[model samples]
Target: MSYCGHPGLMPIEQALNAILTEVQPVTKIIEVALIHCLGKVVAQDIVSFVDVPPADNSAMDGYCLAIADLEKTVDGVLPVSQRIPAGAVPEPLTSGTAARIFTGAEIPEGADVVVMQENCSEHDGKVLLPPVLALRDNIRDQGQDILKGSVVVSKGQRLRPQELGLLASVGVGSVPVYKPLKVALLSTGDELIEPGEPARPSTIFNSNRYTLRGLLQALHFEIVDLGVVADTFEATEKALIKASNADCIISSGGVSVGEEDHVKVAIEKLGRLNLWKLAIKPGKPFAFGDVKGTPFLALPGNPVAAFATFLLLCRPYLLTKQGVGNITTPTFTLPANFSRKKAGMRQEYLRANAEVVDGKMMVNTYPNQSSGVLSSTCWGNGLVVAPIGQTIEHGQEVIFMSYSDLLY
Candidate 1:
């Protein structure tokens, strides 16, 4: 079917905005240990109770001395009054003496500067110093890294490794984070069979189930697997009813306009379904609505189409609903090494490999761009986005998005 000049078809951006406007972020919050909060969104701003490196300390293993004492000596030397190792406190510096200090040791009171041990030598209970010394040299000031009562992490920010380390440094033992979203996953097709089951005539093993599961898992959502529902009105309606318990509902297949496709009708019966004909390749028939107040997303039946649509459409919606501050996927433009003779009516996401040829980075697509061919997706590390009604030539700039950025 030609989607060109179709009045009912929605542009990709319009459809995404419509979906996002209808959904609200989950408000439930839970306290999680700092170590277990990776990939989880923060429910509240985390403020530091104490400054990092609470006290002034040494930046190196050196000697602490008063400047006045060095000036009194004939040479750059002073008597060693005490030894202060890391984690040990020292008495106040004597009027005319130096203290042997190690890295991370707290600065002794009345000491003006720390001279590196390498720049000084010890002989017969006294230490030699450089003639010219800078004040506060090799000394880390208190609150150098973080100040008390400052927000270490803001609300809606997803916790990453570096964020976790920063929180740990400020002695944050636990944090309040949004609860992981629960998603109901369903698949519909009469001719579908699960893997490990005996193969039957005219039956294809179900791959959408596994594909959707992996995508949901990568987002850290709790999946309520509804398995494969038979291609019947009763079965589809029953599945939709059960799925309404989750925060969101996602189904593959049975969304297209075909006699065997019953998901659209079933969803309408339970609540409402806004079936959209999107101007996008691989995935065209997409459904977004709510099932008994729970948001619903229905993807195309084709395996490759399901994968592409999930990344392009469903991913951002899910992230926004989970309270993520930044839901946009990162993309960059690269020169195309290959060419297409004819322009397509719908926006195309071609499975492509990007490499550095000579000194410039170029992208090349898989030989076959068929939606049913799942192997094409496995062969490429990223997708080259071709705009609607646009043709490509060699060395032309094209937008590229990586799976590494999309999967999470």
Candidate 2:
């Protein structure tokens, strides 16, 4: 009948899976300029129309010549028949002659090999190439990077700057991408005040607003920010209705079983909510539900708890809803320098920094693991995942996920 250290807590993985399973990917698509497509999901597979280079190009500033000619020459001396700068079309090579070529210059029609300028000697407009270099020594073959009709970008793949550049290189001017998700972001608590306001009473500036904003921005969401709502049922219900227009509504407080917490009561009147107590440290209370058909996720009030849960749980669900299939965060094992002699009932994600000790990465937790201590995350670079029912010792290898890895 009440919520305090919920007995039926969900395992971290199971909770994430359950949340992601019910969400459907948005199918809407929009065409954006090449430059603006960064951080967007590709709506369709993009097959390149032509080879990346479009032709055989030299990979060095050197001489291009037929390989057969070099084998026949006793003195290895060849006349420079043509000069081919980049963007210049070349005539067929004359017999016993080489074309002077710069890097990125198209190889002559008859040339089968390129000798870098350093390897060949030039005197009186003639180059003497040694026979030590192999055939086709420095030629970038046609279709080497991207062949015509090859898929350059696949459906549901997020476009990074390099991906956008690749699309541009393949002559794609505009890209079809999933429309940016409009997420209604809300923060609550009467003790919270937005930054830039002079504090009149006992209050803390709402850092979660900036925290969630940065997190969503990195994942390329268009946020509809609804600043801190009051701790009343009427206010909470009104805020939910206002946020219902967006595809998803996310709030950072008022889901716990406090007398003042109205998020659960408000959602019950409008829709259904599944308040999950996750078996994870720093973050435990997470609510997933819907209001007026839009998805809703209510996180804990603690800034660090909100951040951890968003990265480890909410982020995957949102990404899946956006059609991204690879929702798992990258993790690696590292030696832990700290120890926990007592086993924990739940998995603990310690805010710890890693350093190289004796050629091995060693992790050390921050001084404080308090959910409200934002400084712990500030000083640490990654999360050392100490599994449930397991005790860790010094020099033991543990699973770790860096903040840089999770955020991007």
Candidate 3:
């Protein structure tokens, strides 16, 4: 399973899918308040017993009157029978009369249609309707948007603000949803310092922790941070032990085979490390395995490498393991604005800025494409994915993928 002449490695996608297929979502459900259920996966389909807009109502502030009432009007004036504002029930409509109903007000017992106030003039105790008006106009029907005993949301659907509002309209106070995936995060490097600490000449501040943490939160994960682990075997083993307790463990910096790196050996000693040297630039070193059945994803030490690996492999895998379907990174074809020299054996993702100009989509890579540079990612909105060993030319079609499309 070696890749690029490296032992103990496999293709990235194959390794990810293998682990994901073996793991299943924690098949437990909890009733959570609808207010806090946004971005959570629904455990089961939610069927509503009550229909939305239970009764026919006006969709706007207008007059609710029978079609026959408009026929007898000699001029534009018709006598107003009653005024029904929103949330109030009106008495049955008397013959030859109209009721003033506000938006969302239930239709009266005998009214069939609602006429907008703008269609004609409204004077003292009188409403005017055009002669060409049709029946049942401007009225919201019962069960129009959602029906009773129908599943409004399917299982494994992520709850959003609009979904919550829809469920509330059907009188659902709470919903059954899966718990957030608990991810253990840590950084392993003796030369790395915390953000607030002063860095020595050869030392750099730890960036992976914050980067991964932010991305994990965006994916609705509950993070358990193990902080920084020194490169020593003892400290690294202890950190791995802490990470093994979580549902999944993610560590950066020690997965590579550099002499100073020791995460791979520690992972093997503690549990397992299925190394995957993917044919992808900036994210070749990937590790996946389990410790006592808890999954572990060991990413590379380079900042861009870690980000790319997480987005391409870990993000979709985690989502699928948590009961999410349609787990794939979205990509689109856009014209390349710059030509670059590339000897392709591996797929390369160049940081690029995309814009639709003159009804055509275009992607232009930034000048700096360093693996360790954080500014390259910040300055670009998406990635230009060039296939394995494929050199791209200016104005040529290229596949572009956005970070937002991958995580959220």
- Every model's TM-score: 0.91, 0.97, 0.95
Best model number under TM-score = 2
Cα lDDT tens digits, model 2, 290-359, are 9988989999999999999998888988998887857778898888898889887778888989888788
Residue-wise C-alpha lDDT for candidate 3, range 119-221, written one tens digit per residue: 8677887877878667888999999988999999889888878999999999889999888889999998888888988778999888999999999998888
Quick one: how many clashes does candidate 3 have? 2
TM-score of 3: 0.95
Local error of candidate 1 at residue 172 (angstroms): 1.6
Ranking by TM-score: 2, 3, 1
Cα lDDT tens digits for candidate 1, 322-408: 999988789999999899878888889999999999899999999899999999989988999998888999999999999999998
Q: Candidate 2, clashing residue pairs?
A: none
Number of clashes recorded per candidate: 0, 0, 2
Q: Of 1 and 2, which scores higher on lDDT?
A: 1
Give the clashing pairs for model 3. Answer: 1-9, 344-389
Any idea what lDDT model 1 has?
A: 0.91
lDDT, each prediction: 0.91, 0.89, 0.83
